[model samples]
Target: MERQKRTTIYDIALKLNLAASSVSRALSNSSKINAETKALVLKTAVEMNYQHNAMASNLRKGSNPTIGVVVPRINQDYFSNVIAGIEEVTYSRGYSLIICQSNEQHAREVDCVNALVNQHVSCVIISIAAETGTYGHLQQVLDRQIGLIQFDRVVDELDTFKVINNNETASLEAVSHLIEQGYRRIALLEGPQQLDIFRQRKAGYLAALRQHNIPVLEELMYENAWTKELGAVATAKLLDLENPPDAIFASTSDFSALGVLEVAANKGIQIPKELGICGYSNEPFTELTSPSITTIDQYSFKMGKTIAELYFEQTEGKAQIKPKTISIKPKLIVRKSTRRK
Candidate 1:
C-alpha cells in the first residue's frame, strides 16, 4: 500500500517545534499569527507539497468563498470590465467568481439568478436584462439572505443595494450641450422606456429641451432603438422627414450612436454642421470614430469596484443595517460629434 500524505499542519508544527495552534492560525491566515511565522508556514507548506483542503476549510467556515455574477451580455466591453474589477477584489480575498450571461432575456435572467442562489453564493451581483422589469427573481435572492448587488442596468422597483449612474442628470447635460451647440431640431434614439435608466434618460432629454424652450416633438422620439441596427433604421425614418432633426441624442449606447453616424454619413449629411450626434456608455470606439462621438462616462469599472466594496461592507457587518442603495453620478464626455462651433 502507498504511504499516506502526512504533511498536515500538525506535522509541520511538530517538525518546526512550534505550537499546533500557531501553525493552524498561520495556515488559516489569522491576524493573531506573526507575519514572519505565517510566511514561513506558507513557504514550508509549498515546499512540503501540502495541498489545502478547501472543502474542509469551507465546511469549517460555513462559506464556499464564491460570488455569482449575472449580466445581459458578457461580450460587451462594459460588462467584461465590470467583471474584471469584481474578480480583482474577490480573488485577493480568496473568493471564486461564477459568471452567467442572460442574453437579454427575462426567463434566462430568472434562471441564472435562481441557479446562483441554489449554489449558495456569498453574493450575487447583477445588471438586469433589458427585458427584465420584474423583481421576483431578485426578491428570491433577498429571501435566501444572499447578498444582492445591482449595477448599471437595474430594476427600479427593487429596493435593494444598487450601483447606478446618474442617467437622468447625464442625459440632461448631454442634451443641454447639444442645444448650446446651436442644434435646435434635436431627435432622440431612445431605449425601452420600461427600464428606469432609459426612462430617466428620456426625462432628462425632455427636461433639457424644455429648459432651452424647444418644442417637444413626439414624432422625433423613437423608442426601442437600443441597438445599432435599430438606431440606423430610426435614423433613416427621422432623416426622411420633410423637416429632419438637426441633432440626435443616441441615448441607448455608443453602438446606437455609431449607427446614427453611419446613416448620416451615407446620407452625405455633415456632422455638427447639419447632423450633430451624441451617444451613451462612452465605449472605446467612440473616440476613434471619424468625428468622434460625444457620450456619457459612467465610470464603469469603478462602478464595479463600488459594487464589490458594497458587498464586502455589508458582509463585513458595517452599520448593522439592511439592504442599501448607492448611486454613482455619471459624467458627460463631450466630443466633436456634438460640436457645432
Candidate 2:
C-alpha cells in the first residue's frame, strides 16, 4: 500500500487562510506572533493532523537530538534485544532512535550510514555487517565530527568508542569445557574471517586445542558456516569424514548450533554421547530445545545499554574527547548438549 503523505505547514496555512511563514512561526510559538493567532494555528494544525518536523528544526539549530542505530539483521533475537536496550536508555534521556538494517550487505550498510549522516543525527551506532570490507563510509561519519560508536562487530583501528564482548576469551572457555568433557576431535563452524569477532573466536579455538596438547586439524574447521543452513551442511560434511568429530562447536551463533543439533538428530546420532554440540550467543530458543544447547551468554541487552549510555557520557556538548574501549566478558553456560556422564 502507498504511504500517506504527511500534512505540512503549507496545507495548514492554506486551510487557515494565512501564509506558510505565519503557520510556521505560530506553530513554533514565536513571540512575534500574537497569542490568539498562535493558539489558532496550533489548534488548526492539530485538527488537520499536521505534525511538526523536529528534525528539520534541530538541523537548523546545528544539532539533532536523534540517534541512528544500524544492525545486520533486526529480526534476530540478539539484535532485537540490543535495540530494545538502546531504546530503554535513549528514550529515558529524551533522545529519539532511528533504526536501520543492512541485511548483511556492505553496499547497503554504506547507504544506511550515509542517510543517517545526511539527516545530521546526534550519534550513529553500528555493528558492522559481515560483508563490510571497507571503512570509508564509517570514516565519513567521523569526518563530520558526529559521535560514532561501534558495538559487537567493529573495526579495531577506528578511533571511536567501542563496546565489544571478549570473544576470544569466551571461545577459549567454551572449547576448554568441551575438552574437559572428553570430546576429542572437535569440529568448528566459523563465520566470515573478515570480521574481527570471528577471527578472535577462531584464534580462541586454536589456542584451546594447543593448550590441551591436542593437534589442530584444518579439516575440522569449516569456513563461513555461520547460518543455520550452512551449519547443517558443514555438519553433514564433517560427519561424512573418515574420522568424524566427536563434538561440534558452532561458535558463530546458536542458530547454527541448532542446525548442528537438528542434523545430528536426523542422522540418529545420540547427543552428548555419540556427538556433542555447543553454540554461542545464548539465544532464548537454546533452553527450549530438546537436550538444551551449551552456549555463551554475551549479555546482548546489557551490551546495547552500555553502548548507548557511553554515547551520552562521552558526547555531551559534543566534547572532542579521546576514544575509549569497553569490553564485556561473556559467560559459558554448559547444558545437556555438551554435558557428558
Candidate 3:
C-alpha cells in the first residue's frame, strides 16, 4: 500500500493564502509572528494533522535535545521511579527521552548502548545490568563522545558522572539494626557479586558482623540470591541447616525478602519471633505484607531527578567537564518484620 503524504507548512500556507515562511514562523511561535496569525496556524495545523519535525529542526540547530536511558528492568519500582524522575526534568527542559531495558543481560546491555550511540542522543544514562562483566561497552559510549551518566549499579573504574547510593553503609545499618534487635545469627541473601552495588552491600554486612564481634559465618551468607525464587530456595536451604539463622537479610531487594517471608511461613516460622527479616528497596508491597517487611528507602525519585539535573549541569556552557560522583544515602525503614525488640 502507498503511504499517505504528511501535511507540511506549504500545505497550510496554500490553504490560508499566506507565504510558507509566514506559516513556518507562526508554527514555531516566533515573536515576529502576530498572535492572531500564530493561533490561526496552530488551529489549521491541528485540523490538517500537521506534525512538526522536531528531529529535523534539532539537527539544523546542532542539538539532539534527547536523552537515552538504559535500565536493567523497566517494571521494577526502583528503576521506574528513577525513569519517572528523569522524565519530569527532561519534559520541563523541552527534552525527549529514549528508554531501553537490558533485562539484566550483558550482551543486551551492550546492544542498547550501541543503539543509543547510533541515534546520536545528546546524553545516555544507565544502571548497568547484573550480568555485565566489563566496562568496554561503557567506554565505547565515551569514545563516541556522547555524554554518559551512570546511576545505581555502576562501574567504579569508569571516569563518568555517577549517581549512586551508599549501599555498604545502608547494608551495615540494616544488619546492625537486626543485631540490636537480638538476632545473633543473621543470614545474608546477596545479589550477583559482579555488580559493584552487591559487593558494597556484602562488605557492609561483613563490617557490621565484625563491629559486633560476630564471627563471619560463610555458610550463612548466600550468593546470587537477588530474586524472589532464589531468595526462597536459599531460605529453604538455610532453614534446613543444623544451626539455622534466627534472622535473614535479603540485601538485594524487597522481592527477595518476600520470598524469605513465604518460605518461613510455609515452615510455620513466625516472623520477628522466630525469623526476623529485612530487605532492601522499600517497594510499595513491603508495607502491605503479612508482617510489614523492614527495608531501605533509596529515595529513587529524588535520585532520578538528581541524575537529570547533573546531566544538565554538565552540559551547561557547552564545555567539557570533569567527571564526578554524587552519592545519595539510603534510609532504613523499621517495620514488624524486624521489630523483634
Candidate 4:
C-alpha cells in the first residue's frame, strides 16, 4: 500500500502564502515570530494534521528531551505513584517520559535499558530488578554519558544519583512499635536479601530486637516471603510452631501483610489480640483491610518528584556534580492491626 504523505511545515507555508522559515519558527513557538502570524500558522498546521518532527529537531540540537524510567512493576501503587510524580515535573520542562516494566527479571531489565540507550534518551531512572546481580548494564548508561538516577532498590556500588527511603529506620520504628504494644516473639516476613533494601529492613528488625533486649530467633525470620502467597504459607508455618510469634511484621510489603491477615482469619485468630500484624509501603489496601494494617509510608510520589528535581539540578549547572544519595525518611503509620491495647 502506498504511504500517505505526512503534513510538513512547507505544506502549511504554501497554503498560507508564508515563507517556510516563518512557518517553522511559528511552529517552534519562537519569540521572533509575531503573535498574529504564529496563531495563523498554528491553526493552518492543525487543519493540515501536521505533526512536529521532534526526533529530527532533537537530532539537530544534539539532545533528546526524553527521560526513560524502568521499574519492577507498573501496576504496583508505589511505582505508579512514582511515575506520576516524575511525569509531573518532566511535562512542565517540555520533556517526555518512556516507562518500562522489568517484571522483576534481570534479562528484561537489561533489555529495557539497552532499548532506552539506543533511543538516545536524555536520562534513565531505574529501580533495579529483584534478580539484578550484575552492574554492567547500569555501567553502560554512565559510559554513554547518560544521566542515571536510581531510586528505592539501588546498587550501592554504582556512583549514580540515588533517591531512597530510609528502609532501615522505618523498619526499626515499625518493629519497635510492635514491641511497645506488648507483642513479643514478633515474626518477620522478608523479601529477597540480594537487594540492599531488604537487607536493611532485616537489619532494622534485628536492631529493634537488640534495643528491646530480646533474643533474635532464627526460626521467626522467613526469607523470600514478599508475596501474598509466600506470606500466607509462612504465616501457616509460623502459627503451626509450638512457640508461635505474638506479632508478625511483613517487612516486604503490605500485600504480604494482607496474606497474614487472611490466613489468621481462616484459623480464627484475632488480630492485635492473638496475632498483631504490620506491613511496609502503606499501600491503599492496607487501610481498607479488616482491622487495618500498620505500615510504613515511603512517600513514593514525593520520592519520584525529588528524583526528577535532583536530575535537573545535577544537569543544570556547568560545574561537575558528584554522585549523591538522597534519603527520604519513611513514617510509621500505626493502625488497629498492631494496636494490642
As for candidate 2, its clashing pairs are none
As for TM-score, the candidate ahead, 1 or 4, is 4
**In terms of TM-score, which candidate is strongest?**
4
lDDT tens string, model 3, 241-289?
A: 9999999999999999999999999999998999999999999999999
In candidate 1 the C-alpha lDDT for residue 163 amounts to: 87
Query: Stretches of candidate 4 above 4 Å error?
Result: 7-50
Model 1, range 214-330, lDDT digits (tens) per residue?
Answer: 999998999999999999999999999999999999999999999999999998999879989999988999999999999998887888788887788778774666767788888
Model 4 agreement with the true structure over 1-341: per-residue lDDT tens digits = 99989999889989999999899999889999999999999888888899999888897788999999999999999999999999998899999999999999999999999999999999999999999999899999999999999999999889889999999999999999999999889999999999999999999999999999999999999999999999999999999999999999999999899999999999999988999999999899988988999999999999989998998899887988899999999999999998876
237, model 4: CA deviation in Å?
A: 0.8
- Candidate 2, residues 28-60: lDDT per residue as tens digits? 779989999999998988888987788788887
Task: Determine the C-alpha RMSD for candidate 3 after optimal superposition of all C-alphas.
Answer: 3.3
Model 1's alpha-carbon lDDT is 0.88
* lDDT score, candidate 3: 0.95
**TM-score against native, each model:** 0.84, 0.89, 0.89, 0.90
lDDT: which candidate is best? Answer: 3
